[model samples]
Target chain A: MRNVKLTVAYDGTNYHGFQEQRGTGLATVQEVLELCLGRLAGRRVQVTGAGRTDAGVHALGQVVNFDAAGWPIPVERIPLAMNGLLPGDVVVTEAREVGQDFHARFSARAKIYRYTIWNNRIPSPFNRLYSSFWPVPLNDEAMSQACDHLLGRHDFKCFQASGATVKTTVRTLYRAEVIREGTLVHFVFKGDGFLYNMVRIMTGTLLQVGMGKASPDSIRNLLESRQRAQAGPTMPPQGLCLEHVEY
Target chain B: MRNVKLTVAYDGTNYHGFQEQRGTGLATVQEVLELCLGRLAGRRVQVTGAGRTDAGVHALGQVVNFDAAGWPIPVERIPLAMNGLLPGDVVVTEAREVGQDFHARFSARAKIYRYTIWNNRIPSPFNRLYSSFWPVPLNDEAMSQACDHLLGRHDFKCFQASGATVKTTVRTLYRAEVIREGTLVHFVFKGDGFLYNMVRIMTGTLLQVGMGKASPDSIRNLLESRQRAQAGPTMPPQGLCLEHVEY
Candidate 1:
């Protein structure tokens, strides 16, 4: 069997995250890839992705992997075939053969996610569905200062969603910064791993700090508490995106 | 009376067009804006846009002007108020007081429109609704050369829709350029005016040239013919957008 790695991009507006559920709903990226691959390889093939973004979340650099029996098709031709089979919203940007043991999720050294907020008093028509529109003024400096406390390894239970089934709540954050360009504010995070809705909760906490609803010190205390109730409300899924993954 | 200028944006996926129509096949952006404005002004207010875009076409910098009979609301508050009433797809990006002479259409000096094509083999999920996805390989150089032939004033009757009721077929094109950034090709046009379906037709012709189905010189001959039958196929409206208007 040969392992193939794919760099993918998707508009997550209509998806139920990246995984396949048993019941009928909108199709997920994983299911679409598996079906296409199965057809191409003439057998059942399962595809796994680096991360699963929630509904309405987008991605630019999502990674996926699958093993296939020896096929006559060239590696470069796989994307072309997938394009013909898959729907428009999920695309393989790049694909290549990888080491036999390469794992799309486990081999990743770092992952980056970006959250966008339209900060103008008026929301934009084109961006209305893709970005979060918040009319209130935000203080980027305060938000960045609060984010500094989040860098390094920490038990992020407070920022995690309640349904996360992982044994350990510990995650290492490489960088967390909030920056503004024009009327848009971007929250960028580089991390070893993220819990369910962790980035969304962190964004909400940072937004509160930026809006002066919470103080910077609150993040430190919130992290220490390890209680989901201590963190700010989870931001909506539409504004978030899986930006990149490094393997 | 006060004149208000609005910079509007919208996702055209669900709209009939920018102008209101007789029946409710799909909502027009004008209908949404008028309804929202009527609520904010507490009186009937009609909005006049820079121009009309076809059904399923989007906009980033569509301008509009409206006259109101009461004390004008603060420009800063207009976006918030309009957003509260407008649907999720339509957004008022900017609202400011303008001279009574500031007409959205007639006073415009130039207008910019962009057509996006996803050139990669696989269609992108994030850009699926926003761009046209074609699996065919496009020669960007050939498309750019073809666009160069369309950069001046000409009779655009061949590029127009057959049922259009416009009085004149002559229009000056300030710029018609095809630019490629990575796998996406952007067809940008700056013009004094456009015939109905002119941009889409131009896109279709250029796409044919890029695919080597037609020569770059063919565009010049087609424009000179002034017969709609000589032009290329009319492209889908979903890939087109009113990018901006300069006054």
Candidate 2:
């Protein structure tokens, strides 16, 4: 069996998320890749993605892996075939053979996610749906300071989704920076692993800090409490994107 | 009566087009703007836009104007009100009182349109629905040379849409540039007036020139022919945008 690694990208507008769910009536990046690979291999195949993003969460560097035997088509032709077969919103960027033991989810070392906010009196016309537009002025300095509260390894149970199945709630964050460029604010985070909805909850918390509703020290206290009620509200998923994954 | 000038932006994915048409239930940006103004003025208000962008065409700085007596809200509140009332894809950026004589369509000195082509082998997941992704390699130098053929005032009948009512198809093109940046190929054109579908047709012609299907001299001959058939195929409208209107 030849294991192939793919660099994938997708507009998650119509998807219910990255993973395949029953009765969702929604197409997923995993489902599409599996079907395409199944057709190419002339057998059933399962595609494993690096991360399972929520519905409407976009991705630029989503990775996937699948194994097949005796495939007749050339490796380069895979992208062309997938482009023709897959819907326009999802695309296979790069494909190459990998070691049989290389799993998309298990082999990942780090991941990065970005959340964008159009922080202006008037939201952008073109980016209205893709970005969260807020009329309130954000205190950039305060937001930057709040990012420091979640810089290293910590138990993220307060930020984790209620139904998440991770055995441990601890994760190490390498960097978390809130940057302001022009009329938009970008929240970028790099971490070893993220619990479901953790980034969105963190964003909501940071936004509260920027709006003076919560102090920067509140995040440290909330993390210590490990109670979801102590944390800020969860932000929407449209502005979040799985930017990159490293192995 | 106060004349308000609005700098608008939209994703244009769900609209029929920028203009209101008969028998089409799909909403247009113009229709949405008119509805917002009607509610704000407590009366029906007719809005005139600088350009009529086609279906699925996005915009960043589309200018629009309307006259009203005793607007209920302040000018600063206009953007927020309209954005709250309108759909997620359309937004009003700047709204202010303009001179009584200012007309959106007629008072514009120049207009700029940008046609973006995602010149990459892999279609972007987030931008696939917004941009036209072309897998083939484009010769930017050839495209730039071809743009030189359309630099001055000329009879643009070959590029105009078939149903255009204007008798004189003569228009002055102040500037035309084909630029390649990263994975995007931007065709930017500034002109005094443009015919319906003119920008998309010009993009198609330039794309043909870039692909070595036509020479730079071919554009000159096509313009002289005054026949739409002489030009290349009409490009899809999804990638086109009315960038701005000059006063």
Candidate 3:
């Protein structure tokens, strides 16, 4: 058995999410990837994705691993071969052989998610699929200051969406930042792990701070409360991207 | 009668083109705009587009003019009002009253068109809608040198697609530049006017120069020949954008 790791990228506009909901008849990134790879292998192939990105959430560098039992295609040519079989919205960017011990989800050290916001009064027709539109001008400095409270290890239950059955609500964030370039506001978060809707909730909270609706220090209080109701509204999924996964 | 001018933007993915084709049932940007704005006017509205962009071509600064007889809505709120009626692919960015003599197509003094090329071996899922993908490494310097040949007045019949009925094949270009931004190669062209498929053909010819398939000086020979067969193939319309128009 050969262990193969793949770095994937997808538009995610038409997909339900990255995870496959078996027998639900819903389209997903993982389901499509497995369908194409299974056709190549002439058998069932199980793919383990690093992140279960939500519907309409794009990805630049999502990692995945699968057992390539008796697979003959060389690692280098896998991308071209798989891309031929894959749909236009999904593409395998890189493929390589990893050790048998390597797991795409468990072996991941950290993940970086980036959220894009178009801070303009006029909505962009081209960016309608990829970015969240916020007409009000954001105070990036205030959003930056609020990001400091999210760093380090903390019980991030407030940011976690309801129905998430994770064992622990705690996660460690190495970096969290709000970067502004002209009318575009970008929020970057690098953490050991993120719960369902964690990044989106954090981005929404930060946007509230930027809009002067909430104090920058209110993040600490919200974290201390551990109540999802106290957090800001969940931002749209289109603006959030799984930017990178560190091994 | 109030003559009104509007600047529009559209993704162009869903439209057949900008011009209205009578009874063809093909969706075009002009038809959609007129359908929405005519609803506001409660009568038939004829929209004259500055550029009759081809199918799948985008626009950031497309200009249009129509007669607004006895319309009561303020010019400033037209964008908001029309955008509500228009589909998600098109939006009116700006609208204002224009002189009676002003025409969106005939009064245009200059126009700018931009073509985007993704110069990467691997296809990008995100750029699929807005860019043309080239797998080979491009020599941008060669393309830059080739752009110089397209500057100034020239009988651009060679670049014009066949079956185009025009009184004069001569057009003057004010600016032509090929800029490289990492994996993205952008071609910018500003001219008094452009023939049908002129910008796309020029971009395809320049891509040949970038790929070393043709020399930079071939542009002059193609122009002098006045034969469309001598020039390069027309690039796809998705990468072409009507960036701006000057009256």
Candidate 4:
């Protein structure tokens, strides 16, 4: 059996999420990709993505893998063929053959995400779909100071959404920084793994520091508290993007 | 009587064009501005714009003028008030009382237009609405060489689209250049005025030169010929943007 890995890019504005729901009838990136892959493979095909991004979250370098044992088409040509069948919002950018044991999700070592905020009095029409508009002024220094508390290993229970249940609340954050480019403020995070809505909650908390609602050094207490209510509100999904997956 | 000049910005994706159609029932930028101005003035209002951009063309600094003889609101407060009534796609960025004799169109010394081309194999989800995607390898040198021939005054009837009647086909191009930034190729043109579909056609011809379909110096012959049939096809309007209007 040949394992085929695909690098995908998609505008998730019209999608429910990355995962395939059984009977929701709502469009999703996974289902659309599986449908196209099935057509190319001449059989039912299941795709395993590196991460399940929330609805309205975009991705520039999402990774996925599928078994193409019986497929007649070469792995190199898969991207071109599948792009023809996929919707305009989703595109298969690169495809390659991998080891039989290679897995899309389990084999990932790290993932980088970027959250964009348009900090302007008036929202720009060009960035409406991709960025979250925040009219208030943001203190970049305060936000950066808050980001310093998030680096390295930590119990991120306070930043995680309440509904999800996981075996452990611990995760390793490799890098966390806030960068400002013109009117756009980018919050970039690279981690071993992220809990449900962890990045969004962290972003909201950092923004609160920028807004003077919270102290920059308060993140240490929030993380130690392990209470979801102690963290800031969850930011919206539209501003989040899966930037890259490092194997 | 007061002549109020306003700086406008709009994402023209949803509108038919900047000019209002008599009976087409199509929404336009002018009509929307007039509707809001009329509401603020408590009477019918007409707006004259510096440039009548085509459908799907964006603008960042489009200038417009309207007489506000009996308007109750002060000119400085017009933008805030009009913005409340304007749609999300259109925005009145700045409003001020101008000289009575100042006209939006006739008093303009030059206009700057920018055309963006995504010259890469993989399309960018963020720039899809703002740029034209062309996967083929473009020779930037050839395109720049072609731009050299289009500088200064010339009878550009070949670059002008048919069905537009004007007193003279000669127009002065103050600046014409092609710049490459990473995967994006930007064509910037500053001119006294552009004929209908003139910029789009010129872009198409330059792209043809880049593609090796036409020679770099062929633009001189195309201009001297004054035959629209000899020019390249008109590019789509979505890639065109009215960057600024200079007085």
Candidate 5:
């Protein structure tokens, strides 16, 4: 059998999420990819994604893999062929053959997530779907100072969403930074692994610091407490984007 | 009686157009604005727009004027109050009281229209709703030369859509230029007035010249012929945006 790896991008506005739910009758990114791949392979094909993003979360470089033994189309042409059958919101950007043992979810070394905020009194019409609108002035210097506490390895239990069943709450954060471009603030995080809603919770907490509601030093106590209640509220899913995954 | 002028912005993907039709049941930007104004005024109100954008055409600084006599809300607070009732896609960026003689359509000195082309092989998920995707390579020099021929006053009958009745087809062209920004090509036009579908049709002809299908000198003949069939096909409405209306 030939293993095929694909890099996908999607708008994620009309989708339920990345994972497929059998009994819910809801559409998902994985289900759409599987449907298109099965059509091209002339049989049922199951695909696995690198990350299971929440509903309304967009992606620029989501990775997925599937096995096809007797597929007629060449590996390089799979992206074009799959894009023809998929919806306009979802597109396969690149496709190639990979080793059989390279699992999409297990072979990932790091993931990059980006959260966008429109920091202006009047919200932008073009950025309505892709960014969260914050109508208050933010101190970028304070937000940057808060990012220093989130760097390196730590127990991120305070940032994890409740009811998530992760085996461990400890993860290594390779980088954390806040960038401001015009009236837009971008919170970027690169980590070895992330728990459910970790990036969104972290963004909310940093925003609180930027707005002067919390001090940058408070992050240290929150991380040490290891309690979900100590962290800020979870930001909306529309502002979050899975930017890339490195293997 | 107070004459209120509003500078509006909207993502026109879900709207039918800027003008309100009597028999058609489709929702329009004008209809929505009037609905909110009437609710705030406790009486029926009508608004006149500077330009009548086609279906799926966006706007950044569309100007509109309405009469508000005996209105309860202050003129400066109208934008904030109306925004609370309008949908997320449409917003009134600025509102001010104007003279009674100031008509949004009649007193306009010039209008600026912008057409965006995604000049790349791969379509972007973020720009799907705003730009028209063109995969082929275009010669920017040829498009610039074509724009030069369209700078002066001329009869634009060839650029007008069929069945559009206007008092005169002769109009003054203040400026026309094509600018390339990264993977996007912007066609900006400023004129005293534009005929029906003039901007879109002119953009189509310029794209033809850039693609080597036509020569830069052909525009002169196309204008002199005064025939709609001699011009290139009208481009789609999604790429056209009413950028500004100058008094």
Candidate 6:
């Protein structure tokens, strides 16, 4: 049985999330993908996604995998076939045949996420759905300087939201950057793996540093404290995007 | 009565157009703005827009003016007030008190429009509502050369769609250029004015050249013929955006 891997992209505005909540009737990216893939396979197929993104969190390069033992369709044409059957909000960008043992989540080395912010007094209507609106001006320099604290290996428990039962709270963060173009601010993160709502909380903490409410050094103190309540609030899902999944 | 000018931005997905059709009950940017402005004035008011964008056509810097005599609210704070009352899809980005004789349409010297195209085999879900999908390789160099034929004063009757009642079809095209960044191709136009669907038709004609189905010189031939049928099909409205208005 050959495993088929798919690179997916989706606008999460109308979806509950990437994870399917069976019997709950909440629309999700995984449910729609499985439905389309199942039809192609002629049997119910189980699809596994690389990330469990929340509602309103967009993705540019989400990854998924499923066994295609019964599906005789060429792997190259899978993208076209899935796109034809899938809704407009979700699409398969690329498809390939992989080893049977390959796992979409476990085989991933790192993931990249981007958080977009509209930094302006008046919000942009065109960007409202895709970006978070910050009415006050932000100090991008200060924000970038604060991102340094998140680099390298660290216990990111303070940045994580509640309800996650994980083996460890430590993680290796390879890169974190704040890039600004005109009125739009992009906070980019690349890490081995992120905890639940970790990127959002880090972004919120950086925003506080940008606003001068918290000093850049405060991030180091927050890390030492490892207290969830001490960290900044989690940013909205609309501003967060799963940018890439590296295997 | 004081004349107030507004720089507006809208998503345009839910709007019929920029112009108000009194009896049609079709929701439009003009109609919504007037409703919100009337409430502020505590009386009826007429609004004049610089451009009448079509359905699904976005605007980044649409200009509008209204007589706000009874509205004694501070002009500097008008944007905040109007944005509060307006829907999430529409917003007043900037507001100012202008000269009494200043007209949003008549006083405009030039307008800039941008048509965005996702030039790739797989359409981006995030860009679906904002850009046109072209699932083929486009020769951007050829398309850019074709844009040169559209520059300078010309009777754009061939590129115009029917149903426009303008006094003349001759308009000065200040700039026409095709810019590409990754999988996104942007067609930018700066002109004294445009005929009905002129930019869209021009873009479609250029696309044909980019696809090698036609030559760049055909744009000159189409202009000389002055026959709408000889040009090209009008591009979808969602790909078009009014970027700016210069007075």
Interface RMSD of structure candidate 4 (Å): 1.7
TM-score of each: 0.87, 0.94, 0.98, 0.95, 0.98, 0.95
Model 4 over residues B104-178: C-alpha lDDT tens digits? 999999999999899988777667778898889999999999999999999999988998999999999999999
The candidate with the higher DockQ, 4 or 5, is 5
Candidate 3 lDDT by residue in tens digits, B88-196: 7898999999999999999999999999998887888998899998889988899889999999999999999999999999999999999888888899999999999
Q: Worst ten-residue run, lDDT, model 2 chain B? A: B122-131
Give interface RMSD, per candidate: 1.8, 1.5, 0.9, 1.7, 1.0, 0.8
Every candidate's lDDT: 0.88, 0.87, 0.93, 0.92, 0.93, 0.93
How many angstroms is residue A129 displaced in model 6 relative to the true structure, after the best TM-score fit?
Answer: 1.8
Instruction: In angstroms, give how far residue A181 of model 2 lies from its true place.
Output: 3.2
Candidate 1: which stretches are off by over 4 Å?
A24-26, A38-44, A70-73, A163-165, A212-218, B1-4, B41-45, B70-76, B96-103, B106-109, B134-148, B163-165, B208-219
lDDT of 5 by residue, B1-247 (tens): 6898999999999999999987899999999999998988899999999999988999999999998988888888988899889999999999989999999999999999999999987777778789898888999999999999999899999999999999999998999999999999999999999999999999999999999999999999999999999998899999999999999
True contacts kept of 3: 0.60
| The TM-score obtained for chain B of candidate 4 when compared with the true chain B | 0.96
Of candidates 4 and 2, the better by TM-score? 4
**What's the TM-score of chain A alone for every prediction?**
0.95, 0.94, 0.97, 0.98, 0.98, 0.98
- Candidate 5 lDDT at A44 equals 97
Candidate 5's error at A224, in angstroms?
0.9
lDDT per residue as tens, model 4, A118-167: 99877676777788988899999999999999999999999989988999
Q: Docking category for candidate 2?
A: medium
TM-score of chain B of each: 0.96, 0.95, 0.97, 0.96, 0.98, 0.97
lDDT score for residue B44 of model 6: 89
